[model samples]
Target: MISKIIVSVLYFAVVFYLGYKGWQNTRKASDYMLAGRRMNPFVMAMSYGATFISTSAIIGFGGAAGLFGFSLLWLTVANVFIGIFLAMTVFGRRTRRMGLCLNCHTFPELLGRRFDSSFIQGFSGLIIFLFIPVYAAAVLIGISRMLEVSLNIPYDWALIGMTAILAVYVVTGGLKAVMYTDAFQGGIMMVMMIILLYYTYSALGGVTSAHQTLTDMAAMMPEKLQKGGMLGWTQGAKFGTPLWLVIYTTIIYGVGIGVLAQPQLAVRFMTVKSDKQLNRAVLFGGIFIPLMTGVAFIVGALSNAVFTARGGKIAIAQAGGNIDKIIPTYIEQVMPDWFAGLFLLGMFAAAMSTLSSQYHVGGTSLGRDVIERGLFKRVGTSAKASQIGVTVTILATLVWAWVLPESIIARATAFFFGLCAASFLPVYLLGLYWKGITKVAAKVSMVGGFAGSMLWLLFVHEKEAAGLGICQWLTGQPTLVSAATKGSWVWLLQWVDPNVVALPISFLLAVGVSLMTKPMRQEHLEQCWANF
Candidate 1:
């Protein structure tokens, strides 16, 4: 406890000093919003990776791995290939060029300018500002729960305290502080993950022995989970079953593809100066991302074997059925005291790195996109207004952190990521490459996608619909899908993620509507592609 307190205090001291440095350097709106478009490639890559892989990836989804087992590593593959490599090379280069050409600082601003529609910007901003709090809450819950377990701090206190610390730097120094601290935090996370993996394997004897032990425990899977089609920690789930659907659709497909359209992440592309920087970022990100998600998932799954060896219990049983608690409880019970302290600091880094970016993106979305550009032409870019927006975002996140159910971290994170994909991916992708995409099509696709995702969540998807209870309240059924006969295709639709359904709808809407509508003026199209 004393060592934990001392390390925590020292960590805060460095964090505050970095925040102060960022504040000292931030002299203009550009510095606050885009870090003056001169951020280092290493910092940019680390910031992007850290923000992308947060406590949600480490604890929330790590805990999910504890439940679902090694199948979740598919997400790590997608995250590395799609999220980092392709995203940086294919999307980042163009986004940076286009943003520079148009002098756009924010993701929404880039789309709005590309389409020449302030409404698109405002609407995108509104969606981000509203839904990002939920995602932020997921990260908040992750670290807070870790604190609750490792330090004996109250969850509420940890949540509030972490939020307060992030708010000071992010609100004052903006992107500069967020990215600066994110790089530092990312390093901490990587080192801790390496240590975690080493210790885990060492505890279980060796890599081959550990995996063999896990494989041998296949039949020992809980009867309930077996009924739900779970195989074991080593073996994947039975295909085409409920457990399989949840693992593949929600955890893998939803978040894997959803990373493409993240608003907070998209903005990071615009913070660098040249394509060379983006290229370097891709290399760094490729190496860094696996350490974050891959290690977390491996350790999470292996915790089952560790627990079984120690106490004849699986990881989930040890965590008392709350998947969110599995990783934290494992750390508390298994890891050394000093390592737990350091790991807590790493979790704090993960949470703060991600939360800071989320808050910055959410705040800027409202302040720069909605208020300044959408509602009033006279109100120029104001950091003060952005600070106010950050405060509001923080409050909303806190409420969600308080009210959101236990084991909701992974689901909420997926919800926001999938929502972002449905709402933004079509327009953002098409607007970058295709000259024929019309403003009206972009508007329609975004709104249509958002509506489709929400409607499905409320009516069709079993997990979210049942959780929200709106469908039950209105129609006396947990979900509209509940009315379907079991074993039918309609019944199976409940397991499909919103991304699987809505992304295609959004893409078709964008393409179909663009073909029918008049294209943007040739001059505007030329201007948007100026850097290309």
Candidate 2:
């Protein structure tokens, strides 16, 4: 506890100094929002990776790996090849160039300016302001659980305490403070994850020996898992299996591709001075993302060996059936006290880096993009409005943390990621590349995508469907239709990710609506395509 207190205190002091520096350097709104677009590539890369990967990836998905086994590593592959590489290279270059062309500061602002419509900006911001809290709550729950388990802090106190500290820096220092602290936190995360990966392998002997042990234990997998579609602990699920659908579509592909359209991630592109920074940032991101995600997945799967050897149980069993708690419990029980302290602080760093970015983006969406830009004619008073936005965002995170369930980290992360991909990806992609993307098409795509994602989650997806209890309340059944029913034979909606269904619906609408509607104005097209 003494070491824990010391590490936390020292870590916070550095964050405070960075926050103060950001405050000092920020004189104009541009500096507050984008650091005057002069940030170095290293900082941008660290910020992007830090913000993109968080407690949700570590605690939440790590927990998922414990239950689902090593197959979850597919997400790491997607996150690297697509989330990091393609996002930074293909998406980042265009976003930076076009954002500069339009002088757009926010993701929604870029979309709105591209189509010459304030409604698009406001609506998009409204979607973010509304849905992002669930994701933030997932991050909050990650560290809050660690504090609960490790330090014996009350959950409410931990939630409030963490949010208050984050709000201090986020509200005062803005994006500059957020980015600097993110870089620092990202360093902590990388170092700690490396130590964790080493400790995990060493706990089980060595890499080859440890994996062989897990492979030998395949027949010992829980009956529930095999029934749910898992073939073993060391391999992917059988094709046409329920667990296979969940892992491949919902967890892997959903989060992998969904990272492309993240509003918060998109805004980072405009913060850099040029595409050169983005190129360099990719090398950093390529290493950082893989380390963060790859280690989490590996450690989560390997934890089964440690748990069985020590407690005569599986990782999920030791965690009391909640996948979210597996990583925290594993660290506390299996790791040395000193490494545990460092890992705790690392988890804190992960949580803070993510939460600060979420709050900053959510607040900006509400204040600058929605209220100030959408409701008011003037933009000068948005600074104060942004504070209000941050406050609201903090309150929302607390509310969600209170209401959410255990083992929800990965699902919550995917839920938001999928929704954003469905709602924003098509419009964002079309707006960037297609001259035919009209305002009407953009608006319809967003609406269609949002509607499809929500409807499917509520009525179709099993865990969420069962959890909501809406179908039960309305029709006296678990889902809208029983799986045993003939009508449910076309159960793709039940098995596939909502994003898979929703994104295509959204893109087709975008392309079809765009085709039918009048093309963008010549002046709008010329402005958007100026430097492409």
Candidate 3:
């Protein structure tokens, strides 16, 4: 116990010290928000990767690997090539040039400037305010689950403690503090994950034994998993999920293409000073994000062998049979006390790093995008306005965190990612690459995607269907012919991943609307296009 407390104290001191130094360097709002717009490529890369892949990936996705088997490995591949490679090559340089050209600081501001529409800025800010908290709450739940497993703390206190600490550094120092702390935390995560991989492998005897054990276990999966085509990547049914319409949705579009639309990630492009810096950052991010995520998935799958050999038990009972607790449970049981402390701190680092970025992005969207342009122009440049925006954002997120409902961490995280991809990606990509995109089209696309995603979640998503008693009510009514004849309503709603539906809807709406409205002037087109 003394050892654990000592380790915790040392970790807190290091983080607070770095945050203090970052606060000292912050003099202007630009520095607080964008690191003075002169961050080095390596720091920016590590910070970006750290913010993107947090406890949600390590614990939440790791739990997914245990339950779904190796099929989910495709996401890591997509994340590397699409999220890193395509983002840098296709969007990075253009975004940096456009942002600098218009003096845009936040993503909503960037879109508002690109198309010459204050409506786009205000609408985009509203979407961020509504959806980002869901994602932030998911991150909070993931870290809280780990703490509950490792330290035997109640989940509510764990959530409160983690949220409070993250809020402090983010509110005090903003982006400069977030980047510097992310770099420091990123180092700890890399080292600790490597050690975890080593220890996890050794615990099961060796790699060969681990693979054999997993292969044996795969043969004994329950009918529910097998029927859903989740047995393995190669052997499952090709189409139509059993209960939920197991469409090819998991691999083709779910998480694979969704990374392109992440708002927290989009803002990173504005922080670097030049396109060359972005190029350099991509190379580093390409290697780091995949390595960390890939290793976590590998370790999570391998843990099944250890659990099976002990008693065929994969999860602890007190945590409500959640697969998300598997990685944390394994760490506490297998690793030494001191190393477990390091592991716990790494988990906290992952949570805090991602949380800080979310808060910073959401705050900027409120401050610069909505308030400054919408209703508070007279007080826009005042320090009080910025502080008020930040304070309100923090309070709103806190309310969402406090009232969060119980759900699997990965599904919740993916839901918000889907929301962002659906609502923002279409407009953002078009604004950067296509000069023909008009202000009216941009607004239509954003609103359409937002409505489509919400409808899907409310009426179609399994969790929502189950929670709202919709499925039960439908099943009870004999006159409801579809529910009686067809087993359940889960299939009707399970055709395509939300991103697949949302992206195309947003794109087509934008195109259709732009054609109907008058096009932008040739002079305006040439000015925006020349930068690329």
Instruction: Tell me each candidate's TM-score.
Output: 0.99, 0.97, 0.91
Residues 1-532, candidate 1: write the lDDT tens digits.
Answer: 9999999999989888888888999998889899999999999989999999999999999998888788999999999999999899889999999999999978888999999998998899889999999999999999999999888999899988998888889899899999999989999999999999999999999899899988898988889889878988888888888888888988899999999999899999999888998999888888888898999999999999999999758988899888899999989899998899889989989999999999999998889988887555437765777788998999999999999999999999999989999999999999988999899999999999999999998898998899889999999999887888987778888888888899999999999999999988999999999888
Instruction: Choose the strongest candidate by lDDT.
Output: 1
Name model 1 segments beyond 4 Å from true.
Answer: 375-378
What TM-score would candidate 1 get against the native?
0.99
lDDT of 2 by residue, 82-114 (tens): 888988888899999999999987898898898
Stretches off by above 4 angstroms in model 2 are 375-378, 483-492
Worst 10 contiguous positions by lDDT, candidate 1:
374-383
Alpha-carbon lDDT of model 3: 0.73
Which candidate tops TM-score? 1
What's the ranking of the predictions by lDDT, best on top? 1, 2, 3
TM-score of 3: 0.91
- Ranked by TM-score, the better of candidates 1 and 3 is 1
Q: State the C-alpha lDDT per candidate.
A: 0.91, 0.88, 0.73
Q: What are the runs in model 3 whose C-alpha is more than 4 Å off?
A: 232-238, 242-252, 315-320, 375-386, 469-492
In candidate 3, position 530 carries an lDDT of: 61
Q: Which ranking of candidates, highest TM-score first?
A: 1, 2, 3
Using lDDT as the yardstick, the better of models 1 and 2 is 1
